[model samples]
Target chain A: MNTTSILDIKNLHAGVAGKAILKGISLTIGPGEVHAVMGPNGSGKSTLAAVLAGREGYDITAGEARYLGQDLLELDPEERARAGLFLAFQYPVEIPGVNSTYFLKSALNEQRKHRGLPELDAIEFLKLVKEKIKLLDLNEDLLKRAVNVGFSGGEKKRNEIFQMAVLDPTLAVLDETDSGLDIDALRVVSEGVNKLKAPGKAQLVITHYQRLLNHIVPDYVHVLMEGRIVRSGGKELALELEERGYDWISRELQLAA
Target chain B: MSAVAPATVRPVEPATEVDPWVQPFARLESGALFPQQPAWVFPLRKAGLARFAELGLPTLAHEDWRFTNVAPLKGLPFAPTLAAPTQRLADGELDARPFARLPGDRLVFLDGHFVPGLSRVGTASGGGVVTSLAAAFRTHAGLLERHLTRYAHGSANPFTALNDAYFTDGALIHVPAGRVIEHPVQLVFVASGEEEGRAQHVRNLILAEAGSQFTVVEHYLGRGTATTVTNAVTEVVAADQVVMDHLKFQDESRAAYHFAAVHADLGRASQVNLHSFALGSRVSRHNIHTALNGEGLECVLNGLYLTDGDQLADHYMVVEHAQPHTASHEYFNGILEGRSRGVFHGRILVRPGAQKTDAKQTNKNLLLSDDATVNTKPQLEIYADDVKCTHGATVGQLPPEQIFYLRSRGLPLETARRMLIHAFAGEIIDRVRCAPLREELDRLVWDRLEQDTQIQVGPHA
Candidate 1:
């Protein structure tokens, strides 16, 4: 167990149903470190996120995940969330009839209650939410509507960041948050993520393209292919991958094997 | 418990034999029941009797009631309350009901007979009439004679016909032309648990003249676990350019049987909204029928039912488009848990030459357990060439993705499930234009969902 690290995965092998996706994957991230996991389609990038968030249907056949010196795999998804672990879903769910503001307030209060903190009343929640939405440039009217319902693609992505800003989790995992955003929405979303950075917080960003890293840069870049992190380097590795696609890494792995 | 032979101990009769209700019907008919009524009511009652005799009790062979089995009702010995009961009710008991605090004219009825002592007949602001049907028989006889048993008396439902044949007393509301009733007239029907197996027939008549507007709420309540039977029928007559809202809220005892029907006659350019909320009774069914008899009229039928335990809630709707440029929209949603069942049958008929007609129907059900059952059918018959009609029905458990999303946000599994279920019901509750009623329903429904232990939060599939 790495007590100082925010997340530690040791030989983690998991899959959905019976097929293995993340095979023998190992990673560790300490506080204040921003790590980006770059991978192509079908490279098990989302499996890792789903496993960490305790999504059902994924079986962790072997190995373990340790978060803040505790077994992350043992905790329920809500327990993990209350323990300050967050996963911004790749596709935001549209929950009809549930007001966005009310949903966020309930989530914030549940986490607060778990931490032995007093729950915020409606007025206090609205005040806090008003300040958080401005950070992501979200429309106030969206708060009145159902959660993520009738939202455009860019609006949904921005809403995810806005929720992350309000929850203020210790470990935030961004899963394909920049997939369907326009250039302006990309900048706004990335800027919002950058503003939420703190010395005590750690972020694990998963993306296919390096365009998002241009705004919210990461300190560490890891290349994931065939369910394993084959290469690791500094931030410049993203630029290298952008210049030269993921084919070279696969060829290099094949040559080495 | 009485000297009469218990149904369980009696021998089973043949299916082709006459219904046992014939004896009770003959006894009640021989006795003097409201002899002071006008001469015209006699013929209407006779016609209703003949219709009920012709229709009889609906069996599994009936196509309209194929999913809902009413055979359980035949085995029970329920005595109809032909006259007023001497049962005394206190004021505090009335205050315990939902929407009891709403400031409006309330007519209280016990076992289907109006109780003047427990009621408050306030004067309408715009020359409207809000009184008991018995009282209106003397005050507004013309309106009652013209509208009472005129719209719903011809319904094919045996329960509606039974109500017409034996209905003792109910509410009679008349909104005159251009008159708007500010406060909704509330008719509270309380079922006292003093006598078990008691039957009550309720009849309500609502007449809104041209340019008039009003809202009426019919609330059915029960005390304890009395196995009562309530057969209620409401007839609404909307004149040209009239706007009206009718809400039927039934929360009876878990051991009771409730059967009700609401028939509306919409006029030219009129807008009528009917809302039904069913939450109790072991076996309950409500029928809503609306006819767009004039051009450019709009009608909205919205309903929500929550069933648990061994309860069954059924809603049957029929919207008839008889004129061009008419519109009708229906939305019905249900939440079932335990071994409860829910049935929805929506039929939209566009008559010949009724061009430019628009009709939409949607029925969605959420089952909380594997044992919970839902049967939904949407039948659309369009004869006009240039009409637009659409309908869709869905039945399933809570979406796992949505539940996971909420749980990922730190909400517990139970809270997530409850929130989703409440939101499913809120879609229909929010359609209520009355703000106070909507707010009350929101709170009441949340409380009901929270207190229900049968709504298990874990995965049932």
Candidate 2:
């Protein structure tokens, strides 16, 4: 199928600090598609997300990742961000002394400058922020304070999504974004994610539980077991895994080995 | 591991001659101007001269002056600014400054001489006195006799003594008991750009009696490229049940030098806040000392310095608690860019009888370039058994995570770093009590930082 692919990974082999983790994993995400990577502990789901986002210290030994037909592996983290690649971190970092509004403006302006568009002024940017803040059910007061400095766990998760909404990346990799959410927070966060998915964009939702997937339904689900995707299927696979747990995948991977 | 020094006998450099800017000023006397003043004025000047002579100018050998070397002063032609009737600077020149219309009483000093035409000299609503030091030396000699020369005599700094000996004019403010001054009493000390290497010694004294309250702004704006030097000393006495705010803003010329000392004595249950902002000059040093002499007094010292282009800014503060139930806190932050340097030294001492003392001190520095440097030391000495004291100093750059987070939002490297730096500075700037004053300082500092960064990252650079 020759539909424009948002991201294409081929035989991705990555490691951290000289220790191999993501071994011989490959996946492809196309425009308008949402893919979920679910696995048990130590299955390298977050590693896959970090490697795709160009985080440092992850040595991609033998593989190729391309975004919009460009060499994604060669770009810096910031360059990748400017190229419309986003990653919602499992643990959003708390940056003290950095105002949320200022950070968002700088980020948006950089992207605009890269695209030869005029940057937005204060009034325009403030209006845009005020509108997007409500999508995640976040308080307007947080925009005036330091970024995620004293935010609750759920608030921080919602903030990651709020940043995504502002940047509007083409390919977003959400890594365990639902790790610390309750039923209400999970529904709000999933709804925010669903709002950002358009026909020309794609998302790779990384999680350890199917509860998040229930809120934000995925078109494709892959079971990553011991550094390899042992099973791939439609949305029904998630349902099976939900009832059977990860032992089925682990057993099948052992039998195949 | 023994690359070069392990096997060799080191060679020590010879000691150099004392900088000419050091001694002569201390010996100079201005007793003639105060001829009609009190009998103790000349003796105070003579004693000041003697004290300055004994101590002399500090060198790198002294721990206090280690980071600051006055050797650069030797190359500049040095002379004391005379009250020799130089041409007056136009009023328009003074009106163009950032804080031109402070909307209150003002005492204007141009080149160390009081100018009556520019001053809106009077008292606040509470019958306080805002007048020139020369005039107050005559009109209120008794009040000056009690508080004047008292703290100046108690100070250990040589510059304080030098100011007493040679200062031609300054401002004096007094607020009586059970009264409140609704507006700030401003002191504007401007250095004329007429002659190169000219110097001025300016002295200011402020006093508030029991149950009194007021605010004072010591504003120093140096114009011209003539390499001027302003040596200033201010002594404050806050009596029982009094509250006062003293803010000193110094934005001198790039080629100028500034040295200042503020000595404050607090009485029973009094509260005093001292704020120092240093943003100019090639070399500057501020010595701020406060004494908590009575029970349950509060002393707060806040300072911020911005330096770039080989500039050196130094701050030294000592907080002494001599009575029971006293609290003192000091906060100082610095942003050093280019090849600039910053130094901070803080000391808190609790005397034997001072029980239940609480003191806190913090000095944080941010270096924007590899060559920028900061030396910070926070010290505490407590003789009392029941006391809580804490001090910390941190020297760091824009945090990597902060930059990365910003960058991930599509911000360029330069913009992200600058934003982080500005926010770091805003932590201290936002603490200024006056809103307009805070906004003015914020704009000036932001503009300077942006321009400096642009120049630093030029194509050829």
Candidate 3:
């Protein structure tokens, strides 16, 4: 394991209630690397994201997951957030009557406070938001409206990336961000994610399709099957899976067994 | 000697006893209360007294009063406030109240009696009339005879009946035909806590003639912890094409009992917006009823209530449409914590031949404690075949998913909870058409919520 890895998972096991979901998952991603976890529906792709974000109702039966050399499971969801981890939800919740601008400002200020930096006032925050909003091609009016109250499918996905831009987290987890986007929306969102990529930052892109990989190419591709990584390879593996589906991988595993 | 009783101690007489709840109030309704009133007014007062005598205090048995119990009122020895306090209010006393800085003409009442010294009356720029009801009797008697007690009669509510019979003074606003009052006329009632169990009955009359426009606010405040009672009645008459905005804000002591009845009669093509904010009092009940009497009229009733501790807040509303092409929308939200309770009953009625009537009502409550509760009922009665009406009621705590979403964005659990609660309240407060008043209420409500330690998500968690 690389000591400077942004994320390191060792035989991680998690389940909801008494039912197991993610079984014996292990992976490692170093600085500035974008890792994509590809699996079919119900292969526990979302569970991996939820477990990393510290969502309630999930029991980590066994394993060790570290974020930036810290025991990630010990921190609360918000603590993980303040420590520079961001999750772009697949289904962003609508919070009526809570202004988006105000919510984003509060989130940013909390992160800043945790980092021992001065909080941004309204003007400063607006300036930052204005610069980042253009990258996602989001309307300024949406910022004034309630948080995701009446957003379209594409707008909501774009909003997730927009928030990632403003918060500027260290490790971004894009959980199926390309699930509900059209080609134009996909291009815009991927562009926004690409713009936020930095040397000291990293990303874990969870997707079920290869079309998104074509836009923001990943450094490493891991094929997840039934809660475990069956194969790991370079970026070429994503194209091969996209052309030849998961049947070949299953056959390969059968032969190996 | 064996009995240890003296002969002078005659058997306690089992004489007829007036109900304790009605005795003190009944004694103050003599002819001397308003000696200068015309004979025609006497009949109205008599009818009010008669209605009060028949109805009396409502109990839990009454269908409308099922959620609220007024049994505690029977124990208090309350007397009508006939005279003002002897001690002169210190300078700037009225200024300490809400909306004091807003530009307007204000009528100050101490314990329900108009205090000229603390009041500021100016000739309305629009040639409208703004004065105390006591003075309006001598000046605008004809207008009063035609409009006063006409809408808010004693038959509907006991509190209104009592107010009609014993109200000392209140605001009398008359926006003449085709005139527009630029500034809101504020009616400020301040309870000095000069004595406990002081009952203040206030009656306000607002008449906006055809093509007139104006705004009026009736504010009630308590200065001390005295167990006072404020029973108020406001009757509004808006003629054709008139625009009237009315607000009633009650923030009395938690030890006080507050009751108010507001009745409005809207004429053809008139637009009326009625708002109520109930943030204080041990037990408060507001009855707001509006009648759409003519065609092309629009009426909106918006209200918000915040209660904690053992306090109880209740609002009962009735919107009646009697003519075609009339629309009414009602929105009310409440935040209750501690062991407090909130109740809302909204009824919409559309009469026969009142075609094209559009009406909608919604009541939402946020319960921050496991012990806190809310009872909401939304009803509709449509006799017309062509009408649109809808209503809904919801009572629940903050959505855990919403809390998680905010927390995932780096906000602490406590901050996220407060923000969501504020948003729930903002849904209604943001409806205030008046910009300054809305902003003021936003600040005041947030300040009050911040001081509440129970507002945090703990007991519910």
Q: Candidate 3 - CAPRI tier? A: medium
The global C-alpha lDDT for each of the candidates, from Candidate 1 onward, is 0.87, 0.82, 0.86
Which runs of model 1 end up more than 4 angstroms from their true locations? Answer: B1-20, B24-31, B123-125, B458-461
lDDT of 1 by residue, B276-385 (tens): 99998998999999989999999999999998899999998989999999999999999888899999888888999899999998999998778999988888778999
Model 1, span A96-214: residue lDDT tens = 99989889999999999999999999999989988999999999999899999999999999999999999999999999999999999999999999998999999999999999999
lDDT of 2 at B272: 86
**TM-score of chain A, cand. 2:** 0.97
lDDT by residue (B100-119, candidate 2, tens digit) is 76677888888788888888
Q: Candidate 2: give the clashing pairs.
A: none
- Separate DockQ for every predicted complex: 0.86, 0.58, 0.80
The most accurate candidate by lDDT is 1
TM-score of each: 0.95, 0.88, 0.94
TM-score rank, highest first? 1, 3, 2
- Tens digits of per-residue lDDT for model 3 on A1-257? 56899899999999997998999999998889999999988889999999998888899999999999999999988999999999999999999999999999999999999999999999999999989999999999999999998999999999999999999999999999999899999999999999999999999999999999999899999999989999999899999999999889989999999
All candidates in order of DockQ, best leading: 1, 3, 2
Interface RMSD of each: 0.4, 1.6, 0.6
How far out, in Å, is residue B428 in model 2? 1.0
Model 3 chain A: ten consecutive residues of lowest lDDT: A1-10
